[model samples]
Target: MKLNSAQLGKHLQGKLAAVYAVSGDDPLLCQEAADTIRSSARSQGFSERQVFHCDASFDWSLLYEAGASLSLFAEQRLIELRIPGGKPGDKGSSALIDYLARPAEDTLLLISLPKLDGSAQKTKWAKALIDNADAVFVQIWPVETAQLPHWISQRLAQTGLSASQDAVELIADRVEGNLLAAAQEIEKIKLLADGTPIDADYVLACVADSARFDVFGLIEACLNGDAVHALRMLDGLRGEGVEPLFLCAMLARELRLLSGLALQISQGTTPDRAFAAARPPVWDKRKPPLHKALQRHSAGRFNHFLLELQQVDAQVKGQAAGDPWSSLARLCLQLAGQRLLLEA
Candidate 1:
């Protein structure tokens, strides 16, 4: 049966199923669902758990061996397969279909895959799994810009804490809706608090000096006309262990939002209306940089920046090969007018 993350806990409370497939772009939700399945099965005497990571070089026969293999301890087993790229080749697909044809009675198989798009879900492999396994798909929802405050409050409540309106707004400003980063920040706050009320002061103290910097910071610094600070923030992001490709993604997203807003404004939309039209940042402070970015940048410039990010993403994925960091650094230099390129 098909289920979302919200339905997973209750579904898992009863007897464990023979097979499960957890898929989504929301990493936190996806991992949580997978953990729930694994944890529940372990509690039900499925002590032997096997794991496989599917890479380009992975052999599909491994999954076949996994399905047919018996546990050495003569106990119930759980096999987990994670497909990062989400495209298992012909052999892998065939193996999965065959295994699901008659899933083992005592063994619970769990598969974690990246979010499957419409095309993928319609494929024979996906159909066989959906038709056979207990499937849960946790799709990421796009947060509305105006509903950010409510979202923050809800997120906080999950950690046995509550936040003041101002605190919600403050965090909303800082994180701007990158849910993964926002979730991490909440975990940090939960660790620091001593059963006291979490307010704006608590948020400022916890998040204001965060070591991690995302693409939003880079675009914000650039729009604020602090090219030096922008570069420094970019460097800090690297120091914080943020991947170069991810950084490029943030820049790309910011540019897309800015360009879309600028175009709307040119067509005679007001700032408040534009703000309403924009996607809410993972943090509320993001609204201001987005606001400032709209003022400082032309629609054309933002569009160009997005294209640069796309090029970087493509290169990092190996579709177009090059030194990704060097390409990223070059993009930054251009942002600072340290490199010359013809304006598109």
Candidate 2:
């Protein structure tokens, strides 16, 4: 049966399913759900544990062997299978289907995977796992901006610390869209709280800017024409020791995407149609900013930025005699519609 992270606790309290599939893009939620299952399994006499990470060269037969082999240590066993890329090839698909046909007795299977899209959900193997009566499928969703404050408040309450509304709001703003960071911040607050009710002032003083700021956020800000915020985030990332090469790589990637989308639009495709056809499939939340960037910059302009990014890449590797960070800042400003006197 399908369940959410919140419902998994109550569901586990009753009876443990033979197979538990926990999937989500949110690392914190997925890890927590897996931890809950592990704890539950241990309490039910699952003492032997085996973990397998499915990578490109993984042997699918080992999964079967793990299930078939009797544990030398304990009667009940917990087998953890993690698929980082969320796609099991033809062999894996067949193996999984065959194994789930009749899961071994006294063995609890826990599969962890990244979020599967619609196409993946329709696969034969995924269908078998989800439709199987003995399996419990739990999908954890990322907390949206609107729900983050309440999520933070709930997490704080769990730690025996009550926070004022302002404090919760402050924490939410600092860690928006990054639940892992939010959890860590909550732990930090718990240590600093000393049983005192958390206030905005205390949070402001103790909590660092642990918000999920990545190269993607920088790209979104630039695309949306928010130069100030984009530059501020750039500085914040730089201060946090983000590498210039990584920054250049992200800038180049976005420039390539914008160029491709612009080319499609120039060839008589509508922005909406072009966006849908773009590789990696730009998410709905990102469509607005991407559309804005495409409208503001032509294909040729994006190509020009791509060339500039190449130069920045060389400077980052110390092969070119220029300031990579300065060039990055200039490129960001230009992308955000500012006219800057940047050297070639």
> Which one is best on TM-score?
2
For each candidate, what TM-score against the reference? 0.63, 0.86
Q: Candidate 1 local accuracy as lDDT?
A: 0.75
Q: Model 1, range 1-344, lDDT digits (tens) per residue?
A: 77877677887888776888888766766777788888899889999888999888888888778777778974898888899988888878888888878786678888888878677988898888877644444443346547767877898898888988998888876765566667778888889988868899988887754343656667667766566767777777777888876787677766677788889888899867877766672234466666666775678877887787787888888988787776776676555544355543
Candidate 1 minimal-lDDT segment of 10 residues:
133-142
Tens digit of per-residue lDDT, candidate 2, span 34-122: 99999999999999999999987889999889989989999999999899999988888998999899998999999999998787889
Flag regions of model 1 displaced more than 4 Å: 133-148, 208-344
Give per-residue lDDT, candidate 1, residue 156.
Answer: 86
Worst lDDT run of 10 residues, candidate 2, spans 335-344
Q: In angstroms, what RMSD does candidate 2 have relative to the true structure? A: 3.7
* Error at 321, model 1, angstroms: 32
